[model samples]
Target chain A: MSEASVMTDELRKQIGVAGEPLVVEMEKGMLRKFVDAIGDPNPLWSDEEHAKKTKYGGITFPPGILAAIMMVGNRPPIEIPLPRGLDGGGEWEFFEPIRPGDTLTIECKIGDLVERQISMGKAIFIYHDTVWKNQKGQVVATSRTYGLKY
Target chain B: MAKQLYYEDVEVGIDIPTLVKHPTTQQLVKWAGASGDYYQIHYDKDFAIATGLDGIIVHGRLKIAFLVQMLTDWIGDEGKVKKLACQHRGMDLPAVDMKCKGKVTNKYVKDGEHCVECEIWTENPEGRKTAPGTATLVLPSRGK
Candidate 1:
């Protein structure tokens, strides 16, 4: 008996294909909620007065907020045959500060796929690349997230 | 908040201040709500155990948040995080002490930007690195 390959031809076709674009508005309430969940006491993310004195001149969301924002929009789902999935980690590059009232367009796509043997036996790693652009059409941030299917 | 860290002030191989976090089940719940990642393994212990985990595990993204906080706090308000990359190699249980630590690896001027690089990671109580990563920061130069 032999195990079937998790990376089928159909799955391989998804690589480099862009998904639907998602637009999200930066709201103070949502930013606060995200900062609160992280338990970070940075005044830049909470206190308007304190942030006003900083170079940012107003409250700014932390880079960590990307973790939450990336989850808000829907993307085309790539069905994998693996039973369990785990977050393998991610890489992010920031080019702008996210502030309240800024509308952002997020585009995501499957960057690549690879198969490897791990302690869990066999796993398929899917890399999702996401780009965030502000209303000005400036690229604010880009991230690559890895998901492990085992 | 700490004093601003300038590119001139950072020395290669020096350790940055560490940020320690104690993540409880309640915090995990808050994270699940905030992140929109209501994965049962992060909040429901029974479901997590059913999937072969010891119990509920801390969210990997939450640990990434901790590491980001550590870097931002070290860089101060004038600094900016340019890039961050990490790998989730191990799982952490709730209520455990997750220590975020980093050491400056290199510094240089690129495209007229003062850049500093560091090796960052979160360590379990037993001194094992659960999530190891690297970060690049742009700090204000004293000359400017």
Candidate 2:
């Protein structure tokens, strides 16, 4: 049927793979707001003195907060011409906590694309895997996020 | 010398205090700044709606982040969140009053660690469940 073929046509071709060594900076205000927005009152993310008493030794975001540092389409070899998209699912692995004022670089790889259609529209799933490392090149967290293009 | 909740302290039918979070476009944008997620679907409403979505949709990870924070705050640093999973059940429209809730479903001990499993969900003002999932955590011993 035409619909099935169109669905297949909508399949996203991996036009490109994002480059590695992508670095991102987190400002203090932004980190504070994110912690506040999530209502995570833990001193770990805000209080430098309190954080110093812990293993991390300074204010730091939660391990899961690494999900915030992945920048899609920000650099070379990025996916081209995506029309519609949605966050489908993701998997996370934590090695260490991310701290404020740390400039982190993400090592990234583009995964296979999946195609499908529904009442909403024809959708293409773009999958990306990334590893976050602190300025010291220590791996902090890794994640794979799936986004849909319709 | 931290405390851990026991399986005996929790009941199957008891409800955990619900948290309601209403994420606005500004908030999502701020999340973008903090998280480095530039997917236009989160910021560009016109383009987002053109895709047949009612409006811009919140990042699935952000929603999970909220859930994670809630569970972590409840369990504390001495505890560990072993695993959490969620299925995208509904759309979260921007600036809408959305509610997040969780309930204790199961409890047990493994490797001498007390653990609790909870059912979590987020809903819209219309009372429609958007994100539903399960979370597993290892709590410290209650006597510690």
Q: Highest lDDT among the candidates is held by which one?
A: 1
Residue A110 CA error for candidate 2 (Å)? 2.8
- In angstroms, give how far residue B114 of model 2 lies from its true place: 5.1
DockQ values per model: 0.74, 0.37
Candidate 1 C-alpha lDDT tens digits along A72-118: 35555888877888888889999999999999899988889998888
After superposition, the stretches of candidate 1 with alpha carbons farther than 4 Å from their true spots are A1-4, A69-72
User: How far is A109's C-alpha from truth in model 1 (Å)?
Assistant: 0.2
- Residue B61 shift from truth in candidate 1, angstroms: 0.5
* TM agreement with the true structure for every prediction: 0.96, 0.74
Which residue pairs of candidate 1 clash? none
Off by over 4 Å in 2: A1-18, A25-29, A37-39, A52-57, A69-82, A101-103, A135-138, B1-15, B37-59, B104-115
Candidate 1: Cα lDDT at B139: 97
Interface RMSD of 1: 1.3
Candidate 2 structure quality by residue, lDDT tens digits, B4-34: 3445566776675676777988888877776
